[model samples]
Target: MTDISPILEFLPCPTPEAWIEEARKPENLAVILVDHANNELKAAQSAMAIMSRYRTGKFGQNRGTSHSNEEKVGLQLKTDDQLSLLNKMSRLAREELRHYEQVLAIMARRDIPYVHLGAGRYAGQLSTAIRTFEPFRLVDTLIMGAFIEARSCERFAALSPWLDDELKKFYLSLLKSESRHFQDYLTLAEAINGASVADRVAIFAGIEQDAIESRDHHFCFHSGVPA
Candidate 1:
């Protein structure tokens, strides 16, 4: 098992026990898997978005459209740092998609049909802390990624004991990658800023802690205490 102590210490607080109880309920199992799949897709999209904006300097302007690799964009990577961002985000996105596929496979086998689930305020709340500028905006996004991945790792560890053997094994298997992803995002954030992001990280931690400990009607993978 991956060592989650560092990740736990990094966060402002732990996931509420009430939320864990909600998650472990048999009725909520479908909701948990579905939301987890959606979250994985969103994670991939987030990484791709970062690469498009920072590496290619163009995104969202050509939605649902495809362009050749050589096509010109607002900006292109001209530095090693920029290329590094591209490389890391590319790998992260691929991994997230793979996770999504794995979750879908599990859902299929379990006969849990994929269904619509609403978004939780956890991410939206954290995203509000992101600045509206360039370099700082990217850094803040990366830090948020770190927080999300770390929380995922923490929750996997917390929930594994309550799950059936199959899911328990699966979630446990994901810890190392999730932990690495958490560290990668933090490393990228600091690299982008050319300085330690401890201050920026602290700001998001407050928001994350509130999101977790607050009363929430939803039972999302990242939702707060059950209302």
Candidate 2:
């Protein structure tokens, strides 16, 4: 695997030390593991949704309108770029799902019950900044994806040293794919925009940093500093 030190420098924000210290507490391990499993599934779902919406062009059509049926039937891979995007997203979705399964297996071995829990406000708060327009919205979304994956990678690296042997190995193993996921999202965003995404990236970087550094009422895999 490639050295993560260089990749960490590319991230817009670093994982907060306060959050890492809170996460290292043994009492929070179960909740963190469970939430990490859910996060993997959610990440896969989000990527799949992007493929469906953009590559297939099926997302924006009004369901109650007369054109809804036509839109649904019109889903087809149109361009080389779309095809490429579809392929990348499909692979990412599969990998993320596999990670979800891996997390579940670890949870089972540790006898940590998988229970449904509400997600933290980190994602929701970042999503609020997404533009409501077409290509711009897509660009913003992809940049947000990059930030999310980058942060996940950062957190995994930060927490790995503090975890038990099994988890430390697992998190270290995940670093490569998580790093690639961040790169893929950024690449797609730049390709789709046909321009540098640096400004938008900077905008979301501030948002992501605030979400990570601020105090939170609950602790989860991606939550900020513990309250």
Candidate 3:
């Protein structure tokens, strides 16, 4: 068997005890499963946005490059900063697309059908948040990515223990990549800004906490408190 054990030490995880207890309850299994499906959807949507805005031309279709993996070709980068931002965002988008593909494969194995639901609230909010700053755009976007990935890592760690062997293995398998993705975003944010991102971190931390804690009609990976 491939060793896919999580690098638990590296994750900023929450206490798993509560999550395990809650997840094992029969009523919560469906919730957890649905949430996982929603997570895949959100990730793919985020990746699409990154490709549409950061990679290709913001206005017209750039042509030729179509798939999620084509980062270097067909995209006309405007500036060095844009190029750098595109590279980082493209990397993230690719990873997210892979995550979506992986989860869909899992769903297929389990015979689960994922319906095409519209975008969730947190994603909409984050989309608006990304448009406000010019120079800070890339850093802000990266920080947002970090926050989302970190929280996903935290949640996976939290919920893993309650899952069955196969699910537990899958959830735990997600930690390393998710944690590394978070770190990558943070690193890019800091590197681009050339200063401590403490204040910005704190700001987005609050926003993310609110995004996670607020009640939402739809439940996704980043959905707020249960409605």
Candidate 4:
């Protein structure tokens, strides 16, 4: 197993008593709606990335490695490099889909309509600022995944006190998995490059920290302080 102890230390869980009190509040159903929808969208995107890059031939002729509920819409990749990249992306997509389902279950029980929050600066910046080199892009993507998962863990822990019992339990359960996901991404980056990713990690860490600290006009799973 990947050693994610360091990231675990960063979790900000609250006391149980406080968590239950917050979870029972009816207003939180809205937050749950947005949270679950965001998970669903992220999962769908990941799966789409995999399908477009890894699937072969016609859809009926060839099947994909990923077996997610999300359909493999199309295979648009032009090279083996893309297939390999999508294979890795498949792993991420699976986990994200699981997260989506988990949140959806909660929302269904609460009778809330799922509504996704907009992309935070973290993911948006990656789309706009990522390097063109494949190797560099891989490293950057891994680092970005790590940061996103870590931030999610941090927020889950932070928001626990304000959540209800079931929700709090779900969030607490997420901490370990999210921490491991962060480590997995970092490890893959190092394994692929066979070079030190420290400088890259530091560079992105600085950006991630800034993103988390800055005031934001909107709030999402990875958004910074609300404006």
Give the alpha carbon lDDT tens digit for every residue of 1-227 in model 2: 44677558766567778888888998889989999998999999999988878866433633344543234434333366577778888999999999999999999999999988887998998898897655566778988888888888888988898999999999999999999989988988787666788888888878887888888998888888788
Please list the C-alpha lDDT of all candidates, in the order they appear.
0.87, 0.82, 0.62, 0.59
Q: Which model scores highest in lDDT?
A: 1
Where does candidate 2 have its weakest 10-residue lDDT segment?
68-77
The TM-score values for the models, in the order shown, are: 0.90, 0.88, 0.69, 0.70
Off by over 4 Å in 3: 1-31, 34-38, 44-48, 51-87, 117-119, 125-131, 214-218
Q: Clashes in each model (backbone N, CA, C under 3 Å)?
A: 0, 0, 0, 2
Ranking by lDDT: 1, 2, 3, 4
Which parts of model 4 have CA positions greater than 4 angstroms off? Answer: 1-5, 8-29, 47-89, 126-129
C-alpha RMSD (angstroms) for model 2: 4.9
Task: Give a tens-digit lDDT track for model 4, residues 140-207.
Answer: 76676766677666656766666778877887887777776667667766755456678777767666
Please give the RMSD to the true structure for each candidate, in Å: 6.3, 4.9, 8.1, 9.5
Model 1 misses residue 128 by how many Å? Answer: 0.6
Local lDDT at 26 for model 4 = 69
Candidate 1 lDDT at 206 equals 93
